[model samples]
Target: MKGNVNSPLHSDYLNNKMKSVQRRHSELKHATPHKLRHTRATLAKQAGTSIEAISEALTHSDTITTKTYVNASNVIPMAVGEIAYRNLKK
Candidate 1:
């Protein structure tokens, strides 16, 4: 609430809050919302989230754009055939 009124939080307010928290916390010195988002995307990709899903979550035009946020190299492509084969083994 901006100045005792109900309202959406602005980016400046968020940034200022982030800075204030960072000042009190030594480990969060370089942390920002954008970096946290990128980290979440990368970690989600590493945790087996599909590129399509990630793209949708990020509201990107396509998966190609999402690839930039996700660590592409660490993501192993699991083809449909491979998934089928794994399921058959089980």
Candidate 2:
């Protein structure tokens, strides 16, 4: 699964790594590259990261696609924007 110098890691490599992890951790049996990406996006959203930032981080051309990655039901109850703003002020 090794890639040539300067080349991106193949999806198969990541998938294999994920499978190995799942073998060791039964709780992660449902994990996959796409699921991991979605989880990261949701976490970033819950952490008060701007949607545009998340979209850019995910290399999405439009926020609409990134929106689907975020799990709205898992959002924090606090004001995420306010928390982010306060962090910026610090």
| lDDT, candidates in the order shown | 0.76, 0.86
TM-score per candidate? 0.62, 0.75
* Candidate that scores best on lDDT: 2
Lowest lDDT 10-mer window, candidate 1? Answer: 1-10
How many pairs of residues collide in each model?
A: 0, 0
Model 1, C-alpha of 59: deviation from truth (Å): 0.8
- Superposition error at 49 for model 1 (Å): 0.7
Deviation (Å) of 6 in candidate 2: 11
The C-alpha local distance difference test score for the whole of candidate 2 amounts to: 0.86
lDDT of 1: 0.76
Model 1 RMSD in Å is 7.9
Deviation (Å) of 47 in candidate 1: 1.3
Mark the regions of model 1 whose C-alpha exceeds 4 Å error after superposition: 1-9, 73-90
